[model samples]
Target chain A: MDLAPYLLLAGLEGLVQASVLMLTALGLSLVFGVMRVVNVAHGEFYMLGALIAWACGAYIPGPPVLGFVAGLLVAPLAVGALAWAADRAVLQKIGYNPEGTIVSTIGMLYILQQGALLTFGPDARAVDAPFYYTIRTPWFGYSSYKLFTVAVAILLVAGLWLLMRKSKVGLLMRATQFDRETALNFGIPVGKVYSAVFAIGAMMAAVAGVLVVPNQQAHYLMGTDPLLLSFVVVIVGGLGSIPGTIAAAVLIGLSDGLLSVFFSPTLAKIVSTLLVALVLIFRPEGLFTVKGRRA
Target chain B: MTKLQVEGLSAFYGQSQALRGLTLELSGGEVLCLLGRNGAGKTTALKAIMGTVPPSSGRLVLDGRELTGLPPQEIPRAGIGYVPQGRRLFTELTVWENLEIGLMTRKTGREALEHALELFPVLRERMQQRSGTLSGGEQTMLAMARAMCLNPSVIMLDEPTEGLMPSAIAGIREAVIRLRSEGVAILLVEQRVDAVLPVADRVAFMDHGEIKAELPIAEVRANPDLLHHYVGIAARPARPATC
Candidate 1:
């Protein structure tokens, strides 16, 4: 049997996984980079997005595509607003103390997980793809929607790069991240920047969740795997470096895909976990850390 | 005209008091040097007025506007610029971004950028360089230029020459003189009597968080013991007054 088709399928799968992982990890990186606070509840935001998308499909009257689009528009905004409120109410009150934020976000994670369980129940549910279009090849057929996801991910990443480089809001965020006291000295409203950054970070995860809902089932406990995977990506990429996050995501995502196809899913996860450990021991600053830049 | 007034300002860090009912006044186009020994609360006084350290009790009025209890971010918007000790530039950002952040609270746009560049012309050439990569003297210039970009009516300098060489010190003195000529009120904090004497119109001696004496530069010049008593420095021989 020719291995070309199988390898191509694995590569495509890796690209799709990498696309979602990058979006999710980028959100985690932004929050950690700017706020210096670990958000343990990040994956819950992704789970919430998927569940919200499922609800939109089930309840909204129209084609599956309409509900998917609605989910795309609504999930990020809703999740972002919730994240903002949480930051102001909990994170700010704690002064964003590193240890305190970790515990607080853990509490948040449980609350969100339990809330989803109570609302959506324990069963896993799936949503239809917005438009079922397939690209057929002599060996096998592929889902065009998966490719569409990759395209969307690239656009979002480009938009983020432009926002960081060219916009005033981006400048404020960068300043705040570099030196909070200096940022305040120049009237950057560091508090507002914190709230906005927290929200935007959660929104990134939510968008990824919405995008991946068609391919994966929405379950209350689904957050665990993505949460773990995202931590791996962010750490391997280096803390606070967006380009690093992207490169790491692709590295880990593709390796996981190929490993799973050739070996086993369990082995794939073990390899990723071991990769993080190796990176930690060898390159603690991350694979793409810039010299003199804070990690 | 009085540009800033601090009436009985006090501040604390935890249970320890840093400023104790400190009072001072700054007028347009004059440099008022706040002189004190280490830990005499000179930096705290500036921090209190800037709202970085919330004054425990007191009133801060800038040009007849009550500044007490305003957030730190709002202080710069109220026409008071601060070049904090250590030249706290956003080191990771380019010199231009640092200046751009200063311009955030002011609408002077390109004109303010031009003014700051004029004050420190070397900064114009180093606009795109990350502030952290600059030499110490250049960092000081960038810090001052960033503050100047606010087009402030009043500006405060907290030990701007603390770690600088003599040439850099001269650059700072010249910049202070130029700022005074532009009619911007300056509240300068300095330990070096020579550095202060050239640009300051008056000096306020602070010890243990309280202002002990306020005198004209000539008064401090005549009373050598005052410097020895408050700041612990022997008075230098009289030279031609520069201000």
Candidate 2:
């Protein structure tokens, strides 16, 4: 058996999955890098986006593209507003206890998940991929929609890199990550930076949700898998290294894609779990570390 | 003209009051050294002025503008640059990045960057090195350089010469002297009396929270007893005013 077509398909799926994970993980990395807050409820923000898409489809008559785009744009703003409220209400009050934050966000996650289930029911919901038909590639004999996903992922990553690395706000972000008090001394409004970062992080999660639903589909429970996988990606990448997170996401995707082809999909899951554990065990500081903590 | 003034500034750590009714006045082109031993609340005084530790009841006037309960970042924008203790130069960031963070307030041109690098020629060579890897002298230099980037009218340094070699301390002393020559009002808080007082124009000693004594640098040099009493130093305050 040539097995080339199947591998290509698997690679396409893996790339798309990696793309979604990388975007969300980038947000997590930035937040953790600066604020040291491990937001466990971040997955809920993605779920909220999916819910927003579904609601848009149900209530308003529009193309699936419009609905998905609505979710991408609207959900983050909504979640960001929620996050701002949450930051001022909770995170600010507690004064940044890592364990406490983890507990609070996990609690938030449960609330969002259950709330969605109660509103939408426990059953999974299907999202019509904005691009409905597969683009026939005579040479590869695989759907080019997968290729489209790859292109979008590349663009998203590029945009994020430029924003974090080149722009003035990007310098502030890095400065914030580098040293909070120094940045403050340099006349940086830290509270504003926090809110902006949290919103952007929330937005990335929402975009991840939109990307996933088109191909993999979304449900109240949909965020659960990505949330778990992103956690794995973050741990493997290091707690706060953007480049490390991207590399780890791709590694995970490739592993899943290849393992799925050779072994059962169940085995693929087992291998991915093992990979996560192995990374944590070996590189306890994650792939990148500056002075024991994530930089 | 007074560049910065703190009136009846009392600060606290939780419930314990660190500073009580502390008032300080510094004019532009002046070097005012706050001299004290540990626990004298010199650090707290700097913190209060910079708005890091909110004064429980007081007002800080920077350039005739009140900085009451203002945030730390805003205080700097009001024309005060602070170099906190331990040279808090984001250990992971490179020297250039540390410099970049300092210039975040202003739109710094290449000239300013070149000026900063020239001011501390060592920083030019060490720009790529992470701050943590820098020697204590380099860190102190970078900290001063970072503060310099804000183009501040007034700068406050908290024990910047702590745990440094004589040469490093001398380098900082020269920098402070140069800063004053450039007309940047400076508040140099130091535990080491002789190390800083030589270059200072005026000196204020703090025993508990409030200023115990305020005298010109020449007056301070005359009273070695004052230095011994407050700072617990046995050294005769040097009479180096002839230089």
Candidate 3:
């Protein structure tokens, strides 16, 4: 069997995986980096987004494109609202204590998972692509929607980078992250910023869900793999470093995709797990982060 | 006009009380220094006014507006700027970024930035540098400048001259004087009586979380035993009698 075409296909698939992983991991990184809250329920937010997209796709009375677009628009807003409420009612009430948030988010994870299971039922569902088109490569044809996914992910990440670097809200978030007391002394409402950041983080995960639902089935438990992979990405990227998260996501995503294609999926998982362990032991601060940078 | 008035303010940290009926007042354009030994509750009194420590009892009013029980973030919005004891600049951020954060409450723009730079020209030269890398004196200037960015009517400075060289202390003294002349009321807490005596309009001696004595600058200057009694420092040569 000629492996060259297969390799090319694998590399493209890797790009797709890397793109989605970057979006998901960036959300996780931002939440942890700024709020110092380990949102164990992050993966469930991804799952909720996919389920919301599936529902929107099914119920919206429109063409497939319009339905998919509605799903895309609705899922993130819904997830963001849910996350914001959770932050205010639960996390803030708990004082955002590190250990407490971890436990609370775990409870949230189970609640979200079980809620989806009861409402959406046990079946996996898929949404139709907004546009039906294909691109002819040198050796084969490829789904143009997948390419669109990659492009959209890139654009969203770029937008996020700009927001963090330039906007007033971004400035407030950074200041709060650096020193909550000092930020408060400066009259920046730390609690409100925390809720906003939590919401934004969940919205990013939901976006990844919306983008990927057309290609993958939306199941109640589908968030597990992405959650695991995102943790790997964040850990290897450095906990709070945005650039580090992106770089780590690409590295892990490409390796996972290529390894799964060339070898077995099980072997790919094992290798990625091993990579995380090695990184944790050898360079705990992550590959891209400088020493003493806030984790 | 009285810019700030504290009456019978008391605060407790957990089980132990840190402040006991601390009472003081500051007029617009006046500098009131709180001088005391460590654990004398001078810092606690400042924290209570800033709302960082919740006062158990008493009323705090600024410009005739009640300030008790307001959240710490809201206190700054009520025309009080705090330069905390440690000069807590956001170390990771650039000098400009630190100033930008400081500008949140006042909404002052480029002009405020320029003003801060003019006050500490070294900041202009180090705009892009990370604040953690600045020298101790430069950090002190940045802290004061950051607080001043709020355009606050009343500024509270806690231990601003701690660990600073004579030149840095002199720089701070000059800044405080300028702010006073511009009609900005100041509540300064200092252990160094010599550094504050020249600029303070009145001095309140605190011991055991209560004011032991309140005297005018001239009175404290003439009575060396008062300084020795409250602040525990031998009376030093007073600033030239120009002012």
Model 3 stretches astray by more than 4 angstroms: A1-4, B109-114, B223-235, B241-243
Return the lDDT, model 2, position B28: 84
- CA RMSD per model (angstroms): 1.9, 3.1, 2.3
Writing each residue's lDDT as its tens digit, candidate 1 over B1-243 gives 999988999999999999999888889999999999999999999988888888889998999998888889998988889999999888888998888889886755898889889889999889899999999999999999889889998999999998899889888888999999989999999998888888889999999999999999989988999999999989777544342
DockQ numbers for every candidate? 0.74, 0.63, 0.71
Residue A6's lDDT within candidate 2 is: 74
Model 3 residue B38 lDDT?
93
lDDT of 1 at B70: 89
- True-vs-predicted CA distance for residue B109, candidate 3, Å: 4.7
What is the clash count for each candidate, in the order shown?
A: 0, 0, 0
Alpha-carbon deviation at A1 in model 3, angstroms: 5.1
Which portions of model 2 show Cα errors greater than 4 Å?
A: A2-9, A56-63, A118-121, A132-141, A288-295, B94-96, B106-118, B121-135, B236-243
Between prediction 1 and prediction 2, the one with superior TM-score is 1
C-alpha positional error of residue A193 in candidate 3 after TM-score superposition, expressed in Å: 0.7
TM-score values for chain B across all models? 0.96, 0.94, 0.96
- TM-score for all models, in order of appearance: 0.96, 0.89, 0.93
Q: Is candidate 2 or candidate 3 better by TM-score?
A: 3
lDDT per residue (tens digit) for residues A1-295 in model 3? 4899998888888889999999999999999999999889999999998899899889988888887888788989999999999999999999999999999999999999999999999999988988989999788999999989999999999999888878889888888888888888899999999999999999999999989999999999999999999999999999989999999988988888899899988987898889889999999899889987752
* Better candidate number, 1 or 3, judged by TM-score: 1
Displacement of residue B3 (Cα, Å) in model 1 is 1.0
